[model samples]
Target: SLKIVFNFQAGFGILANMFLLVFYTFIILCYRPKPTDMISCQLTFIHIVLLLTGGNIWLWDIFGSLNIENDFNCKATFYISRVMRSLSICLTCLLSVFQAVTISPSSSFLAKFKYKLKKYMISVFLFIWSFNVSFTSHRIIYSGIFTNVSETKQMKVTKSCSLLSMNYIIRALILTVIISRDVFLVGLMLATSAYMVIILFRHQRQHKHLHNLSHLRASPEKRATQTILLLVVSFVVMYWVNIIISSTAVLLRMYDPVILSVQKFVMNVYPTITPLVQISSDNRITNMLKHIQSLCHHIFKKR
Candidate 1:
């Protein structure tokens, strides 16, 4: 039952992210893409790949036929997934910071920094990719299948590749690195999101007498900022929930299948919802979708 639930969730997540990937790619190709759009496109593309890879692993685990049991395949999937997850958080932070900087008052320090950073956006993206890849290299080295012996004198092979460290000191160091990286990224995302929210609030307050309107309806920048904030909040919530569940499982040394399924479901939630939020908030995508629907309707009417 848990396996069925996981497969269902993974299938839905893959389809959603695949549509997002294609939509963003269309935007990049047909529309004048902003820096934010480019970032979103890259993020969506990564999500699609991650979802496909993750879904395959889950399906394989259920069917028990696909031969992904080798060390190389395990390391590749584990490493790529870890790197992509970290990259997703970093890209989200970049998106929030970019939106915040774009919406900052012209005379503010952020405005100045934004001006300086605009010319080197590609370089910044490259740095993020390199840094995350280098940082997560340890996963490739530490992840492999291991055998465990139960008290009943029965030996079982672990189904999935996981981090294996016999040395306590080495394990501690790895754990420290992983935890610190996650904390730093999550902190950065929260701070940037908070700053953007404050800026939006002040702007709205200053114009309160003009008209009462939601921040999302105020301006394009505000709408984009609000959308990014929503994305960040959802990502952080799901990310931390998965983290907490996994950490608890690790600490208790208990591998409850239901708990693991719940963790994966939580982790997939953000990817599933991100595209929906993006399309709903952006008038261009919504307009494009509507146009497509109308065209199909008209063609059917002619038939």
Candidate 2:
């Protein structure tokens, strides 16, 4: 049952992210996209890589069937997975900050960032990718094929890849850095989310009062802000839950298969749900889908 559940989540997540990948690419190449859309496109791509690397998708079994397994494969897989996971949080935090600035009033200090975001968005993303890639590079040194299950110093990440123990001081320093990064990014996401919520409320209140209207629908900015808040909330909840389970496993020396399976499920949940949420809330995608459906219906009726 556990295996079945894990497969279901992994399969569904990959498919969802793949769809968004193509959709986002089309929008980016063929049309003018909102700044937030570009961030989301990159986030979507990161989710795809995370699902592919971190979720494993039975790669261990395939490697075994192929009769080829080595430290390089194990190390490369985990290293890429770690980098993608780091990128996930960093990009999500960026998304929240940009949305907050995008929705800020023209006179507000945050509004200045809106212009800078457009000018330096790609540079910011490149920096994030480089930082995370460097930050998690230690995985290459510490990760390898697990040859001895009895070795308590190794923590199993996948069926084949395990993290070898490092020097006590070095391990402690790495842990501190990772914890600091996660905390800082999560806190930033929450702060920006709160700011967006406040701006949204103020806008609604003033909009109603000034227009003498009570049943107004959400504006485009309001919808975009709400979508981002949802993403931030969901990402935070999943991150903490995964951290709890993985931290517990680490404390126990990371030998438990049950705990590992649970951790994978927890990790996959956020990526699986993220793209679905974005697709459903995105008016452009929804309208495009509707257009396709209508076009298909008209052709079928004529036939």
TM-score for every candidate vs. truth? 0.88, 0.94
Model 1 CA deviation exceeding 4 Å by range? 55-63, 149-160, 214-216
Off by over 4 Å in 2: 157-159, 210-214
User: Which run of 10 residues does model 1 get worst, by summed lDDT?
Assistant: 149-158
lDDT of 2: 0.86
Model 1 clashing residue pairs (backbone):
none
Give lDDT tens digits, candidate 2, residues 1-303.
876787778888889999998998998999998888799889898888888778565765577788657998888888888898999999999999998998899999998878888999889988998898888899899888887765777877666668898999998999899899899999999999999989988887778765755667777788888988999999999999998998898788756888887788888888999999999888888999999999999999999
Clash count for candidate 1 is 0
lDDT of 1: 0.77
Whole-model lDDT values for every prediction: 0.77, 0.86
